[model samples]
Target chain A: MPRRDPAAFAEFVAARSPALHRAAYLMVGERQLAQDLLQESLTKTYVAWPRLRDHGKAEAYTRKVITTTAITWYRRRSWNAERPTESLPDTVAGGHDDAVTQREWLWTALQELPPRQRAAIVLRFYEDLTEAQTAEAMDCAVGTVKSQVSAGLAKLRDRLGDRFGEHADDLLPPTLMVVTP
Target chain B: MTELLKDTMDQAADSLLAPDLDVQAMVREGDRRVGRRRTAVVGAGVAAAVVAAIAVPSLLPQDQQRATEPVGFAAVFEAHQPSWATGSEVHVGGRSFDAGHQVFAYVQTTEGVVFSDPSGQVWASNGTQTVGVGRTDAEHPRLEADGSRVAWTTYGDGRPTEFTVYDQATGEVDGLAAQTGDAEVLALDGTDVYARDGREIVRWSLATGTRTSLGRPTGIEIEDVKAGVIAHQLPHADDGATSPYFGRELGETLAPDFYQTLALSPDGTTALGESEADVPALADTATGAVTPITVPGYGFFVGFGWVDDDTYVGLGVNEPYQTTPLDLLECEVGGTCTVTAEAIGSAASGVVLPFGQSMDD
Candidate 1:
C-alpha cells in the first residue's frame, strides 16, 4: 500500500504548499507555471516516499526539485517574458507614488534580472538561505551566489532606489543573519 | 555596499516569499499514481506469462530510448517530468563532459559552471568554468567518475549556497558552513578541490580547509538578465541594455538558442554544442575557438555528441522543405561529416527517478 499513515504527509502538504507556490510564482513569475512546478515536485516526492527514509530531508529534496524545476522552466523560451504583470491590487493601493509603488516597482525591476539572479534573490533574501545553502541550491559556487546576489541587488537598487525609504541599503545585507532566538 | 538597495531587495524578497500549494497536490497525486502503476505492472507481469507474450513487443513502440549503459558516470539535465506511469522522477537537463581524469558538468539555468571529477570518485577543478553561486537555486548533485570525493549543494531555504566537498574516504565536509558562507566544490583532484565563496573563487585543500585565491576574474561578466530559454537569440536591443528590451517588457520569453546542448571530449579539450547556431559548432574550451558546421536548408543544430576530441556525432534536421524526424550526423575536427536518418517508434511519457538508496549512490 502507500505510507501506512498518510496524515503526516497530508499535513506536510497543507503547510508547505502555499509557501512553495509563492516561491515558484516568484521564480517563474507565472501562477499556472508555479502551480505546475509545485505539483511536479510534490508528485515526485510522493513517489519517492518509500525511499525518502528521513522525514527531515523531504523538504530538502522538494526544494531541490523546485529549484531544478525553475531552472528547467527558465530554459524554455516561452517562460521568459519581457515584463511580469505590473497591475497592483487595490489592497496595497493609495500611498505616495514612490513609496506605495516600491513593492510593485521592485517586482517589475526584479523581472529584469537574469533567471539565475532572480532565483538567487528569491532564495537568498526572500527564502532566507545562507550563501552556502543558496550555492548548493543553485548548483554553483558560493562566490557565484554572492556575485548573483550582489549583481541582482545592485540592479534593484539602481532601479528602485528612488522609491525606497532611506536606510534601504540595510535591506539586502551581504551576509544573511543567523536564525537565532 | 548600499543600504537602500539592500533594503529594497530585502523587502521585495519578503513580498514574494509565500508557501507553495501546487507542490502539495502533486505530491498527493504522485503517491496515488505510483501505487496505481505498481499494481498495473504487477498485473502486466501475470498476463505476460500467458497469452500476451507475442503481442507485448508489438504493442510497445520505442520512439524515445533510455540510455542505460553506465559509463564512468551520468548526470540529469531538465528534472523529471511527471506521467501516469512513474509520476515525476530524475531528469537530464543540460550537458556532461570529461576533463582528464574526471567528468565536467553544466546546465541551462542562469547559474552555470563546470563541475568535474578526476577519478571515478574524487573531483577537482581543471578549467575556467567557475561556479555561479547566489545566482540561482538549482541543485543536481553527483560525484565525478571516481567516487573518492563527493560534491553537492544545499538547496531550498535562503541559506548561503554551497558546493561542498566531502572526502568519501573520511566523510568530513570541506569548506564553508551552510549558514555563513557560499560553498562551491568543483574540479576536485584527490583531497584538493576548488571551492568558491561569495567573495571569490579559490582552491581549497580539503585536507586542511586552506584556500588559494584564483584572483579576480576579468572576462567574467554577471548579467542579471535571463536569456530566452529555448528560442533562438532574442531580438538584439540597439538601446544598449544587457538583455534586449523584449525581456524587460515581457516577464519571460523563450529564445531557442538558449537551449544549450553541450558535449565534451574525454580529455575535455573540445566541446560540442547543439541547440546553438543553425549549424553545429565545435568549440575548443581551452582556446575558446568556435567553428560552426554548416548544413544547407536546416535550422539550428539540435543535439550532438563528442565521440572523441577529433570526431563527433549529432542529431539534426537535414531537409528544410520536408516535415521529417531529426537525423544523425558523424563529424570530424576538420568539418568533414556524414548524415543519416533513423525511423524509430515512440514511447510513453513518464519520468522515473531512482529509488532511495540508489540516489545515494
Candidate 2:
C-alpha cells in the first residue's frame, strides 16, 4: 500500500473545508456540531486517503462520511436529547422581513426532519446531486432516496402551509411542489 | 419549489462563516486511528498464529474427535459463505447447498438447515432435498433454532400474533398462539420461547401452553434472552444514556455502556458488548467482568450471535467509513477470531447470519 501524502491531504482540506462545513452546518443545524462533524469526517478521509486512489473524489467521500456520520449521531439518544432549542429572532432588525422569516422557518423545518430525510434533502437540493448519487452517499437504495426526499419535501410544505397559509405555494420552488404533490 | 429550496439552503449555508480548518489536529487523529487499527490487526494475527501452532494438534485426534463430539448447536456456527455470495447459497459444516430461493435467515440442525426466504417462507434443506416448512410475515420476521427445533414468530395485521416451532426430527410444526397480540419472539431455549410483549418480557412454555411474565414492566426494551436469562436496556435517562441489565433483577447494571447491538450467549453465561474501540467484549453475566476480544483487520463489529456457549460470530467491517467488504468473523470469548468468510458483501447485500438477524435487519 502507498503511504498517504500529508501535504496533499492538507491541501484538500484547505480547499474543501468551506463547502463541506457549510453542508455540515445545514445537516446538523448547529455551528459547533457542524464544525465537529466536519473535523471528524476530515480525519476519516485522511485515514482513507491512501485507498482513495484518486484524490479528485476526496470531496465526494468526505460528503458521504459527513452524511453517514451525521445520521449515526442523530440516531443516538444522547444527540437528540442534547439538541439545543432553536430561538428565532423575534423582530426583523434589518429590512427584507418576509425573506428573513421564510429563511428562519425553512431552516427550522429542515432541522425538524428525521436524520435520513434531512440528509437526503441536503444531498439532493443543497449539494445538487442526483437521486442515485444521493443514495450512494447515504448508503441506501435509489428508491429509498426518492421516498426520503419526497417525505422531507412534503413535510416542509405541510409546515410552510400551516404557517404561511395560501402563500405556501409561492414560497416553495415549482419543481418541489410538483414532485411532492 | 426546487429552485427556492436550493437557493434557501445555499443562502443559509453561506451565511455561516466557515470554522478554521484544523489540518494538524485532523492529521494527528487520523494517524492515531490508523496506528490503533494496525496494532490490533498485527496483535490478533500474532495471537491466532500462536494458537494454531501450539493448540491445534494437541487438543484431539481427528478420528477420536469425530466419534466423541455430538452434532448440535456447534454445527450452526460452521455455516458461512464467502462475503460475495448471493442469498441463494447456504454453507454449513464444510458443505454447500442451494436453497433455490434467496435465504434471509437460517440455522443448521442435525437433520438439515432450516431457513427463511425474503418472502418469509420457511424451508429445510438436507444436502440432497429441500422442503418448505412454513411461512411468517415477510417484513422483519424473526427465526431462532436450538437443539432439534426451529422457532419463528408469525405476524397478523402487521403485529406478531403467534409463534411456530418446527421439529426437524419428526418433521412436525407446532403453532402456539401468543398470549398477547403484539409479542415478538426473542430467543428459543428448548421448550421455552422467550418474547417481548410491549415493555415486558414474557416466557411461553411450548409443552404446557402457558405464559409467564418474567418481571414487572417498566417500559424496558428486551435485547436478547437465553435460558431464563434476559438482557434488556432501561428507558433513556435524562442525559440520554441507557444502561444494560441482565436477568429480572434490573437494579444492577451489567456494563457501563454498550453500543447499539447486544446479544447473550446461548447458555446465558456471557454477553457480547461492543467496546469503545469497536471490538466485541465478552461480559460475564454474573460477575460483570468484560473482556475485549481482538479481531484482525476490522474496524467495527456488529450483529453478534453465539454459536455455542463460549464462541460468538458477528459481521466485521474492515473500514467503518466505507460500508463494503464485510467479513463474517467467529471469535471465542477469551480467544482470537478467524475470518470465517471474507467479502461477504456490504450492509445492503441482504446477507444474513444465523445470529444477529435483528441487527442485520
Candidate 3:
C-alpha cells in the first residue's frame, strides 16, 4: 500500500489468486463465475489498498470479501453444482481409487448444503481458520459458525455415510504448511 | 483428522482449477484501472472547461447575472462505482477470450454498453462486467438498446433476416422472425421493431408481434429509429435532400452541414453528430447551434454513445482510427471529458478495430 511499492499489491494478488480461485470455486461451484468473483473482490481490495494497515491482513480481507460477496450473490443467482459421474475419472482404468472416490463424493455433497453452512465448513476445515476466525470471516457469532460446521458435516456424513468422518485430518488446510514462526 | 480432511479439500480445489493463469494481465488490468482513476480526476478539470464554455450555454444558461455560477455536466451518479472499479474477462462459448478482440458499435444500456462482433455475436460491458448474446451474420448489423433490452438483426445465409434480442437483467435471449423477403431491420426502440419491406416502412411490436404500417410508400426512406426518434431522408421531389431527419415526431431535419447524427440523448433533444470539424460535436436539434466536443487528451475521431440524458461514453480511436485502446471516455453535458485508457493511439492501447465505422455511422 506504500506509495513507493505498488508492486507489493500486485505480488500479493498474483501469489494468492490461485488459492482464492479454489476457495471461490468451492463456494460458487463454477470456474468462470469463481474467477469473476475473485477478480471483482480483488479489484475492490486493490481500490482500498491504501487504507489497509497491515499488509499481512490482505489475504484475510480478500477472504472476507470472497465469503460475503459469494453469500450476497446467492439471493440473485444459484450456482450449479458439479455432479460426480458414476464412472471414474479417465486416469484410472475401469475403477476409481477409494480415497479419490470418497473425496469426489464429498465435493458433490458439499455443494448441496445451503451457502452459509458450506462457507462455514470451507472456512473452518478447508481454509484452516478456527471457529472464531471463521465467525469473523462469515461475520457471524462463534456459535453460528460451530452449528453451521456441525450441520454441514452432518449432511456430508448423511450423504457419504461413516466414511466421511474417517478423513477428519484431511480437513486441515495444506496452505498452512508455508507459514513459519 | 483435520489434516486428513484438508487433503481432500486441497485435491478437490486442484480438480476444479486450471494449471496456468496469467496473473500479470489481470494485475496490470487492475492497475491500469487505478491509474485511470487518478489521471481522469486530473484531466477532467481542463476538459470540463473546454466543454462548459461551449455546452453550458446549450444545456444551461450563462446569463450575466449568473456569470459567477459554476456550470458543468452532472449526472445522478449517487453511489455509482467509478468507471475504473469494474473489469471482466471476455467469454465466448463458455470459454474466456484470452487476448480476445474488443467489441464495437455499442449502445448504452441500463447496466453497460452493448456491442456486436463480425459474426453477429454481441457482448455487453460497463467497464468490469461482460456477457455475450447469440450470433448474427447480417453484414452492417445494427445494434439498439433501451436499458437492459438489446436487439440486432441476423442473416441466415441471406434468407429470412432475423432479429436477436437480449435482456441483461433477466439473462434471457429471444429471437423475432422479422421478414423472409428482401427487407432490412433498421433499429429497435423499446418493444417496437422498425423494418423495411420493399419501400413500405413497418413498425412491428417485439412483444406482441403485431405489425403497424407507419407511412404509405413514398419517396422518403427510413434511415434509423430509436425510442420513437426517426432519422430518414425526405422524398427527392426537391432535388433530394442529403441530410437525414432527426428527433421524435420526426420534426427537425438534418442540415446539409452536419455529418449525420450517430446517437441521441434519451429525451431526443440533443444529437451526437459529426460536423465539418474533424472531431464529433453535439448539435442542438431545437436551435441551429452546434458545439464541437473533444476528448481532453486524445484528438482522434472516436466512437460515442449516450449514457444518460446528461452524460455520454466515448471510445478513443488512434490516428487512422484502427485501434480502440479500450480507453473509456466519460463526458457530461456541461463539463469536460476524461478517458480511462492508459494512452491514446499507442500500440498497447485498446483492442484492434480492424474494420472501423465512421463517427457518423
Candidate 4:
C-alpha cells in the first residue's frame, strides 16, 4: 500500500497484464473493451495503491476490479442491445479443420453468454479458480457464483450443443452437469 | 459428462495463452515516462520564464489557447511506457509511424505494424512491410503512401506530446526540431510535411526552410479534405478527456473505437471518416452532411485511401485478425459495403494523405 514500490509494481504488471487481458476479453467479448476495462482497473489500482493491504492481493484486487467493472458496463443499457459489428460465426464443431478454427468457435460461444454468466464461466473455467475464488473475484457471494456458473453452463450447453459434445471433455468444467437422458 | 466439457474448456483456455506486450520494453518505458515527465515540467517552467520576458499582451484568450499544447505531439513519441505499447516497436521510415493504435495512413504490406492488443493483430500495412507494431492506445498515425512518409503524435512522459518522422527510402530519423514547436504531422509528402498546431495548418519543407500557412481551420478537428469532401469526426479530446460535443451529440458518446481520420475523395466533394460509436461515416464537402456507412461482417476499417476518385480502399481489421473476407471494399458515393466493422486499432485510424492529384481530379 505504501507507494507500491514502483519496481515491484512494474514486475507485478509485467507478469499479470496478459492474464488480466484474457480474463477481460472473456468478460467483455471484445478486445478494445477488454483493454479499456483493464486500463480502468489498473488506473484505479494506481489511485488506491496506498489502500490495498497486501502486495500479494494486488492481482486479486485488480481482477476483482476488472470483473465488477465489466459486469457493470454490461448492465448499462447501452452495451446490452447494441448491434455487434462482428458477430461470431457459429464455430461450434462439425466443420472445423484446424485448431485455430475450433478455438475461434470456443471464443465466439464464450462471447454469446450473458455478462455475469460469462464472467462466472470464464473465472471458473479459464482462470482455473474454484467457486470460492471466482466468487471473491466477482465480489459476489459463493451462492451467487454457483448460480451464475449453473446458468452460464446451461447457456453454453445450449449454444455449444453437439459441437461441444465432440470435445466436451476439453471445453467445459467437470463440475458442470449436463441435463441429459 | 463433466470431463468432456472440462477438457474442452481447458483447450479454449490454452488457446488464449499467447504472449502479449513486451515486458522488457514495458518496464523500460515506464521508467522513461516517469523520468521524462519530471524533466518536461522543469523544462517547461524554465522555458516559460524565458518566453514571458519578451512577450507583449497575448492576443488570444486562454480558452482559445492551444489546449492540447501542454501535451505536445512529440512528447507522446518520446514518453511512451513500453508496458502500454507492448510489442510495438518504433517504425522509423522516411517518417516515424507511432500513432497510438490507429494508423492514419500506410502502404500495402504483408508485414504491417500490429497494435498491442492481446490478440496480436496488425492494423495497417505499407506494401508487405510493417510500419509499427503493438500500439494499443494513442493517436492514429497519418501517412502519405505515394511519397512514402508517415507521422504521428503521442503522449510521452508528462508532456503528452511527441512526433517522429521515418524516411523509408533513406532510413533517416529526425528526433525533433526545436523550431517546429512539437508539430503533429497531419500529412507527410517526401520533402514536405503538413502539420497541425491546434488552430492553424502549416506546411513545412524539409528541403526548403520555408513554412507556409495553407489557411486557418475553424477548429482543431481537421478533416482530410480531398476530392472536395471533408469528413471530420465529432470533436473529442485526444487525451480521452470528456468535452462538449461540437455537432449533434448522438445517444452514444463516441467510443474510443471510432475511427477519426477524414478521408476526402479525389474530387474533394466527399469525405470519409467514422464517429465515436465506431460507425463508418461519410461527409459532404459542400454541405457538411454526415452519413453512416455500413461496416462488413468480419473486419473493422481503421484508415481509408482513394484507389481512384470514386473508389476508396480501407485498412483496419485486415489479415491475421479478421476472418472477414474482402478487407478491401469499394465504397461509392451513396453506396455502402457490408464489411465486418472492426474496432479501429489505435495506430490504424486516420485519413490517408492526399496523392498528387487535386480534389477536382
Candidate 5:
C-alpha cells in the first residue's frame, strides 16, 4: 500500500548510495553485483516507502534487503548460466608480490564464504557494526550470526591457511574465537 | 588484526565502487523497473503435447497393487534434516566442510538427486551413497537435470561463459556452444537446450548439434520445456513473487507459490499445491481455473509433487504442528492422502529446488 515519494527516495539514494554500495560489494565480492543489489534494494524500498511510518527505518530495512537479496541472488544464480562479462577482477599489476597474492587469496577466500557469513563479517568488521546490529540486519537471531560468523571465519582460515599470515585470529569475534594456536 | 582485514576489505570496496552513483539516473532506473514490474503479469498450456513428457513418467505402475485395500501414491523423498547441509561430511573439490560447504542446487531424478556442491562439482545422492559426477568448473553451475541428463554452465569471473551437459547413465559429457551470440545461456533441457542469447531465445539441440531461434511468445522467458509444453517465467524476478501462472502456451497454467511446492499430474489434468491450505486441486489449463479436490485425510501431508495424474506424492506429517520425520505419502485426486511409514527415509526436506520439481527423485 506504500508508495515512495519521488523526492524523498531520490534524496535517500543520493545520500546513502555509496555506503550501501560498499556494504553490498563487501558481501558479494563484486562491484557490478553490488550495484545490482543496491539498485534492486532501493527500488524495493521505493515500493514499500509509503508503508514505512518512520523514514529513519529505511536504512535498516534497506540493509536487511541487501543482505537477504544478496543471498537469494546467490542461491538463484547458482543454477542459471552466467552472462559473460569482464567483471572478474583484472590481473593485478603487482601480481608477483606475495602480499598482493595474499590479498587476492583473501579476496577469493572471502568470496567462498556463504552469503550470510560474508554478510556477518562485512557488517561486524567492515562496517564496524556490532554482532547484534549484524543480526538485526541479517534478520536472524544473534546466535545465528555468531555461528555464521564462526563458520565463515573457519572456512576462510581453512582455505587461506599460512597465506593469510598472522593476525588471522583477529578476524573472528572474541566470543566465537577460532585460533590455530 | 581486525583493523587490517577491515582496511583491506574497505580498500577493495573503494577500488571497485564508482566514485558516486548518478542520483537522477538511479531515480530514473528505479521508476523504470517499477513501471516494468507493474505491467509484467500475464498468464499457460501445451496440454496434448506435454502428456507424453510429464505423464509417461508418472503413469508407470506402482510396486504395490492392492485387492482389499486401495493402493496409494507417494514419492520416496530422500529426507535429510536441515542440519545435514552443514554436517561437514560432503567431499567436494577434495575438501570436506559443512554449513558453507553445501549443495547449492539439485535435480531430483529417479536415479537419485543430482546436486551441485558449493565448489560447482556435481554429485548424485539417493540418501545413502553419493557419487561425484564430472567436476563442473562452472562457478555457479546452473545445474538442470531431466531423466538421466544433467547440465550446468561454467562461469569465469562471474558471467556465464559456457554450459556443459552431463549424462549420468552413459558417463558421457558434452559441452554446448550453449551460450548464444550474446554469450548468455538460459535453460538446458536434455539434448534440446534453451538459452537467452541477448533478446532471442536460442534453441540448441545437443543431440542433433543444430541451433535455431524460437521466436517464443514475447514477455515470457521459457523456464521449463517438456514434451513441447514450455513453462515460462518472467525475466524480472520481482514480478515472479506474486504471479500464480508460470507462463501461458495454449491456456492459463497453475504454478507453485506456497512452501516452494508444485506438482503437475502425469496426465497434466491435476495440479497440486504444497501448502495444506490448498491441497488436492484440478487445473483447467484452458481457462486457468482451479478446482480443489477434497480428500478424507487432506491436512495430514506436505505436498512434494505429483507422481501420477490420479494422485500426488509427498511426505506425511503424522504429528500435527511438529517437526516430525515424514513418511512417504499419496493424496489421491478426489481421495485421501495415505501415509506409508515403512518408507521411513522418504521425505522432501533440506533441498534447493530451482524449478520446484521435488517429487522427481
Candidate 6:
C-alpha cells in the first residue's frame, strides 16, 4: 500500500538514463529501439519502485529489466522480421585504420548473434560485469553464461578469421583466446 | 578480445546521442499501468463475490451432500491458507502442514501431496505428517502423481539412472532400473510411466516390469504426458524457431515458440501452452486450437493442473519480474478466473503450489 515517489524516480532516471541508454543501444543495435527499450524498462522500474526498497540497486534492477525486455522483444517474430538499416562498410576509407574496420565488423557480427548470446556478450564485456553478475542479469545459471559468452566469442572469432585471416589471432585478447579448447 | 569487444561496443553505443529523459511521460505510463492493475483486482474481487452470492443459494443442497465425498483437485481451491505461509508449507483440503524444508516442486495426489526439496529429497505429506519418499539428482526433478502413486526419476551424477514410484497406500517405494541413464520420467499414468531417453519416448510398465519404446517422433523433448497424449516441442529450426505440439499422432501444432512448460490437463484433451512474450493459452490436444486465457490483473498465468476437464489452477504472477508476488488463481477454460489466494510470495521465495511441481522445470 506504499506509494512510489515520482520526484525520486525522476531524479534516478535523469541521472542513470545516459549510461542505461548506451547499454540499451549496444543490446538492440538500433537507436530508436534502444530509446524505446530504455523507456519501457524504466516504466516497469517505476511501477515496482515501491517494493524496490533499496534505491541503490535500482540501476541494476533497471539494467536487468532492459536486458530481459530486449531479449523478449527479439524473440518476437515481428521484431525479428524488421532488420536494422545500418550495414558494415565494405572497404576501409581513407584515414580509417584496420582497427576501425575490424570494430565495424565486430559490431555487425555482434548484432548477428542470438539475442541471449548478444546480451551475454554485452553484459560480460561491454558492461565489465563478472560472470556471476552477467548470469544474474540474464536470469540464467553461471554455467549458461559461460557457454553463451564462449559460443558468441567463438562465432565472432570465426567470422573475424574469415575477414582478417591470420591477423584475427593478433586482434583477440590472450585471455579470451583460451576460451576455445 | 574482451577489451577490443568492449571498445567496439563502446564506439557503436557512443555513436548514438542519448535522448532527453522524459520523466513525466514515464511516470504517467507507470502510474496508468498501476492504476489499471488496481482497478482490475478490485473488479475481480467484486465479481467473485457477486457470483458467489448468486450461486451459493442454489448450490447449498448439493454442496452439503458433496461435503461428505472425498476431496480431489477441486478441494484444493476450496482450501485456504494464510498469506504468510512459506514455500515449504503444504495445504490440502481443509488441512495445512509444513514439509520442514523448502519444497522446490510438488504434486497433489489422492493420498496427499508429494514434493521435492531443494536438496533433491522427495517427501509426501498427508496434511498430518511427512515422510521421505526418495531422492533425485536431476537438475530440475519433475514429480507426477495419479491416484495414490507418485512417480519421479532418480539421478546418478546428474544423469537419470532409475524410474522410481511410491505407493501412498502401501507406503512402499519401488524403482525400475533405467535402460539408459539419459532417460527422465515425464508422466505417470496408472501402470505405465513415460520417459524420454535420448530421442526416444519410452514407456515402462510398473505391473509387468517391462519397457516399450514409443518410437522417436518430431519433438526434441517431451514436455508432459497424460492419458497417452504427449505435449512436446519440435527441435529448434534453422531459424531458431520451435513449435509445441500435442497428441500421439503429432497432428496439430499448439503454438509457435511455446518455450516454457507445457502442462497437459488431467483428461489429456487440453494442454497449457505458454510463451515468453504472450499470455497462456489452453491448446486442444486433438486439434491444436489455442484459446488464450487471461488472468485479470496478472501479467500471465503458470498453470499447475486442471481441477476438472475445464477448470485449471495456477499462480497468476503479478508481473514478469522475478521479485513480484504470485496470486493463486482458479480459472475455467475461456471463462473467468477467481483469486483463490493473493500475494502468496514470489517463486524465488519457494512458494510451491499443490500442482506447481512441474512449473518452470
Q: What DockQ results do all the predictions give, each relative to the true complex?
A: 0.14, 0.21, 0.11, 0.08, 0.11, 0.22
Put down candidate 6 lDDT per residue, B16-91, tens digits, no spaces: 6766667889888787555333211210000000010111111111111111223343334223221223566655
Model 3 lDDT tens row, B227-249: 46765545323222233466565
How many angstroms is residue B236 displaced in model 2 relative to the true structure, after the best TM-score fit?
Answer: 4.3
Expressed as tens digits, the lDDT of each residue in B214-327 for candidate 2 is 775554555555665666666433222234677645545556434323567666777776543344577777766667666666666653555567676666776543446666
Best by lDDT: 6
> Against the hidden reference, what TM-scores do the models get?
0.37, 0.51, 0.42, 0.33, 0.40, 0.53
Highest DockQ against the true fold, candidate: 6
Error of 2 at B153 (Å): 1.7
Clashing pairs in 6: A173-B1, B106-B357
Instruction: Mark the 10 consecutive residues where model 3 chain A has the least summed lDDT.
Output: A172-181
| Model 2 CAPRI quality | incorrect
- Tens digits of per-residue lDDT for model 2, A1-181: 1367889999998888999999998888888899999999999888767645557667887888899889988887555567984544444346387777787788788888888998999998888888877876786788888888878877888899988998887776553443332
Error of 4 at B260 (Å): 40
Model 2's i-RMS, to one decimal, reads 10.3
Q: For model 5 chain B, give the 10-residue run with minimal summed lDDT.
A: B39-48
Off by over 4 Å in 5: A1-181, B1-104, B125-130, B134-142, B157-160, B180-191, B216-223, B233-263, B266-270, B273-282, B293-302, B315-328, B341-361
Candidate 5 CAPRI classification by DockQ: incorrect
- For each candidate, report what fraction of the true interface contacts it reproduces: 0.35, 0.54, 0.31, 0.13, 0.26, 0.53
Of 4 and 5, which scores higher on lDDT?
5
lDDT (CA) per prediction: 0.42, 0.64, 0.53, 0.44, 0.50, 0.65
The local lDDT score (0 to 100) that residue B161 gets in candidate 1 is: 61
Over A1-181, each residue of candidate 1 has an lDDT whose tens digit, in order, gives 1142366666667777766666777777666667678877777666655434444456755665688667866777645554355333334434456555555666677777778888887787667787777865676678888778778777766666566656455444443332111
Model 4, range B1-361, lDDT digits (tens) per residue?
Answer: 3444344445443344443444444444433322221111100000000001111111211121111112222332222111111122233221334433332222321122222222322243322333332121232333332222333444344444444444433333332332334445554433445566545666555555467775554333433433212233332212111211112221122322233443555445554555422346665545445667665653444325543455554443434332222233445556664332223233222122222111111
Please tell me how candidate 6 rates in CAPRI terms: incorrect
Fraction of native contacts in model 3? 0.31
Candidate 4 Cα outliers beyond 4 Å, as residue runs: A83-106, A162-181, B1-361
Candidates' RMSD to native: 20.3, 18.6, 25.5, 19.6, 22.5, 16.0
